[model samples]
Target: MLPFENIILIDKKSSIAVYKQIANSIINTVRNGVLKPGTKLPGSREMASILNVHRKTVIASYDELEAQGWITVFPRKYVMVAEKLPLLHPKKWDETELAYSYDNDLKINFRIIDKSWCVERDTVEIIIDDGHPDVRLSPIDELLKTYRSFTSRQPAIKSANKGTAQGTVRLREEMVKFLSITRGLTINTDNILITHGAQMSIYLAAQLLLNTQSTIIVGKPNYTVANETFIQTGTQLIEVSVDEYGINTDQIEQLCKKKKITAVYVIPHHHYPTTVTLSVERRMKLLELSNRYSFVIIEDDYDYDYHYASSPYLPLASANHQGNVIYIGSFSKLLDPSLRIGFMAAPKNFIVQCTALRKMIDVGGDGYMQNALAELIKTGELKRHLNKTKKIYHNRRDFLNDLLQSQLSEYISFTVPNGGMAVWITLRKDYSVKQLQNTPLLKIIRTDEESNSFRLGFASMNEQEIEITIDLLHNLLKKQ
Candidate 1:
């Protein structure tokens, strides 16, 4: 049976603005596998009495959620969970929208793509990218020929009528092999449940572990997409301060003592936007903390593939002796973003719960993509492609670094990752970054707290385009 989860009461000592804290607590309960997805929550009056807060406060918190699409409210006293929604890969930019936008100069393309919604604009625009990995590096021609040549196209996926919940077996087998080599993780077809992308993987993890009112902590100014994923799943995100080693572990123990934190989300391996790697010492400490606090650690291993540095550190999941790490990753950053194709590495004990949550939300991932990716992995096409593209992205990273130093050195600075697709460029001065947002050259979509740093997707662009864009951006920075 699930543990006791109760009405959230905000204390005077809570640092989160009371409304945000309350709403997030509710979300945490729903997402962290606590409050079952469709369970009805207590009425505002009832909740207020339980929490010792004014009815108006509860109503106000519920109102914030209603506006943001978290819950549905009936005229009087009825509140129910909205349906569980699945996040597909980050493929929101539609060509129809792109064709009509009429911004000819500001053309962006998916060198990589998936569910990142915090673009500076609400409407997802096809971000013109310079750093997409060379798809030519992949045997696209051979794969297409093989795809067409398949004489008997046996219905790509078979377990359809049964609610394609466990993902295609062929795909799971391939994914298992990939994890064993890449992350030093091992699990057979039964352990790995495929999802559209890492976004869904993380969401599914939250769905499995948390309930409304459970505390879920993440890095401060975390990747907006993951933040949104947790928030949408009804998990309240507690932002923790991070440093070179990783999240402030001391605060984690403090927060857990103060509140029943159900999960802790971290990008210990080359974190998003900041590009900081968690020291191995810290990875073990975090595992220890999780064991003590009874919380789960979400390890987002997004860029483990394109390691520019020698002997890149192993994943937090690798070091998770307590078996509490929920490891998530995507193929998008390594090779192709459009392919989506990500999975989770959790303890055997937790897989059933996660799969049950996934089954409720998305019966199974797309059959065609899963089958094709399975074939790609089985035939060694994906691995060969990754090896070939790594050199190119490494070169692109070098080129972009050179261009930044040569042209924009005095004005701006960026973190050079040992290996990753994009550079997390934080301006030495904050105002310059803010001013750049006003340019037509700059396209902002759904941008929130990530106003201080801009991600330059270096792996998507060719060197020439990279050089020219950097030149153009250098002049813009000078003007700013």
Candidate 2:
């Protein structure tokens, strides 16, 4: 007999009964061919003494093994391995099978798509991102307190686990009230669906609306991620030029006349890459075109709350009477991007479809965080934070603009934006982004080739960092 002590080691702390553990160990040994058929096992009394388990425990293990056809028990005499074990099919091993490489058999059919937008910099110290918010301003303590409070309550914990994909009812209700007062929209909780972020909302919208036969009208230098999302849906993208006054609506109307456009994706408030607000005249024209062409208008007002100069334009959804607009917004800009909280506002039927699709992908959003945000909104903490950040961002924006004009006037030309986080600086045609990126002093900033612009985000940086970044850019430009 193989030493029973070496074969079966019982764990007293395990939740599994001692007898079951012994039975499982013996079964595993049998399956592994460590114990051959017809091999005799120790008597229960001797096994119990060797294993340091109760004699009854050893008897129960032997009984279980016999019941499962792993062993046969002779009448009060001995326990032997069964001639044929349960659920075991012994196959002869072929040495030739080991010669084949899995690499050829396990091949990936899909092509890898690169979605990297930011260049990796190892030595760069200052980072000028694409209009990201300062997470230092986040009320982490208050949020944690609210989260702890919710988790401490049994009812809240239970409700969180059973939350709907459309998000918690309380958060939805709070969102309805918040959007109504801030964006001047008359909407209820039924018209809203909370999403992971604006990116997820864009993807869900694209999935519901577009097909291979559909055409999506977008700005020439639009949000790259949104453009990629539409592309992944197998839809044709018709790029219209975006100037100082936003996407050319006249061109969009011309496309509408030629083809049956499915949707028009626009960042009308502050166009990505170029922080130019859509002219009021063009906004009206786009709305009229959407109504006439029967195309869905995807208005991505991502950073709507970060306006500095003047009152921001009301979202297209607020004036959309024909129900052709699906407005997407995110609190990621106001809070932290990692929070991943965004909302989509559309017709109730559309929202219902989005909710169903969202359920298929994700069971629900973070209920605790959503509930905490709702509390912040209800108690005016979110509003106060926004107000405070707005002033700080506005100051930073102005300061960055002054530094750019004073230092980089010879090498770059830019228009000061009315109400966005970053200014769009156009490097002189002679200078290449590649050359700037190679320079050690200017590697921190990201330059876009699609728009011939550099989006220098000022909202996240302090005055000292901003000055240092500007000084570095000035020195780099002077070297050229």
Candidate 3:
């Protein structure tokens, strides 16, 4: 049985004040022991419907009841009977009630907005989840074999901070070999600083490179987490518009001449939210601008490992001649989020200061995880596992795209991302994002764009789950 099953909704539209009438009914119920402690009162919608008035009016009455200690309202979605509050209560209505209503000039209540259908957590969603990179896809057997080999050796375990901040010699050496052969990035261990995640590396760069006086430039509709971090650090955020070719290098040149822009952040391989890759020509132009402007380029190498269509772009850091580009990379994305291990390749001059900043922020990453991850890469388990996981995620992405194209394309425009776990979607102009947002069960952030752009998380959902979510979204959009 549900709580607060008793109290009948009483609606009386009269000259008497609505709040008073509602309050009077509740007081009477409590006085007669019809309402008990720890009982949840109906939501504003439920009460307003029963009383045939606006939900706000019922809320005002509840507010009055709560102020007088007759009841309580929680920040969470619940109103309840207060604990042991003594109130003057009458079993039945008195003549004074009519006289009080006449004096107060109360009239009617407003109808309630139906809000019971949506789950609140869906309001904001995380971009990366624990399920991606399908750890199962990784050669767990191979990793365990390496782990057993490591444990079985019983070699002296080094402290996390023993080697250069770029990471231990063994790991950095492995990465140098991996990037040199794969991405054509010729980086040595001295040029790289190992970090917890690429974001943490980004945050550390912000701390070391930016302060209250610095102005950081980012693309419009940027990654939410990076934006939040910038705001917290009090750095001025400059939003540059992006074209189909990726970030408009022309706009960036203009901004550098005008504003005191310190750092530029870009997702060159697969741009966040929007899957447009920075074309090779634009990357060269961006690198040139960074040199000309005397500012550092922050290349977020996010999802560089999961290229499905086009070849991955050579990173901005790979072209750093002026020592101004800070190239960031991470395995947490394809390997595991919990691994909390990534590397930043910066100019040799900035490594010490960046290390100081990194030490102050997290000191050192986990030795065990680092060693295990290094072993995974050293033994080729990392690349082997990533391929398997990417294939699975690619299938899920295809399924979602097919559903949207078949059923939702008439209402929404979307492109399959060449890489990454998220798909960028633009809703039809016929439907306003604000309307969809206010609709019941619509779980999205103030949304990525003022126009209707929503990111669908396919990494965590199975094909069936993705189908259900798409159907629900279709119904919701159709209603609007």
Candidate 4:
């Protein structure tokens, strides 16, 4: 009946038993409306004869169907499709139609918040990124070797899946020593909370500290993402001027005198876009202001590793700020951006709250990678890698500065930064920075048309590649 032999196909090689396959086939046939509710199935012996299978296999299939409530069986009576089956309308198959596919044009019923704040990603082969590290120089092999070591061991496997929201114990322990030696930060494991990246750390701090009634202070042309994150919290973001000496701390002091400042977000070392380090005097002033005003200080020291000039300034968090500073740093700059490992150091109580908040969004981080980094630090591989890359980046920065000065000095002017991997170039009044943006061969990562300036990152490119980029700019300027 209904070509039972043709419909109930089976493979002896399949992992699923033939009986279960037959039962599933019969259930599908019923669901597909080929067999109506209350329709009688052929007897087990008859089905075995029709399907050319053993009688016991057919009996077992019938028993399974009966147990699953797909069919009703009676002693010395026929097996039938369940009479009280839920109604399921059969979908007509169409050869020309493709539905339930990965389509972006979704007809959503609910309202979504405006995503105008989100930056759009352009698919480009070669882009002048905003001071990214050269991934070619990353210690991938050593990291992978450590990763393999972890995967091969049972204890490591258990530790990885242990799922601690604060991050792996080995990494936190190593980070305490690492920060102490590198940044002069006197922090312990409890004060640290590992995050996906510095952006996550920044966002978490904003969410915890700022609200509608809160007011946060940032530099005028601060890190765009941090500015956006602060704004999204419905906090009043007061922007002060950032001159050659970094954010005007005096202006910040004036603002603090006028109203209560909730938090101050500062990039003291190599300020974003401008590449100006905050004066040591201003650094002391800001700390004093934070203490006086009773405001939190979110110190974002991303890319603190690649400072080319003399010894880099120690972070505000490094100095005694009386538990008022939340220091955020990232390994994304240290290694590769996609690796996405960062950490936040604050007071133990603040870190506990951050870890709790982190769990609500993400249960845990990549324990394997964290442990691998810990091992690297322990073996001095991370430090060696950093030392080697720092030299290369410093050379590249100087080379690019020379090229810009020698080749395009007529069109643009820039301050050769002491420590960072980028040059803060101010374009001439005659030419718009927009011209550089439109060049097909080159993509300027950032441009301020109002200020007639753009930041050119050099660390990601070699001397030869930097030469090519400069030549391209020279040719474009000549055309303009």
The per-model lDDT (C-alpha) reads 0.70, 0.87, 0.73, 0.88
Which segments of model 4 are wrong by more than 4 Å? 1-125
Model 4: lDDT of residue 131: 87
lDDT of 2 by residue, 123-170 (tens): 766667888888998776788799899999998887766555998888
Candidate 1 positional error at 256, Å: 2.9
Cα deviation at 447, candidate 3, in Å, is 2.7
Task: Encode model 3's per-residue lDDT on 319-343: one tens digit a residue.
Answer: 7458788888888677656667788
Error of 2 at 427 (Å): 0.6
- Candidate 2 residue 36 Cα shift, in angstroms, is 29
What's the candidate order when arranged by decreasing TM-score? 4, 2, 1, 3
Candidate with better lDDT, 1 vs 3: 3
Highest-scoring model, TM-score: 4
Q: What is the number of backbone collisions in each predicted candidate, taken in the order shown?
A: 44, 0, 4, 2
Better of 2 and 3 by lDDT: 2
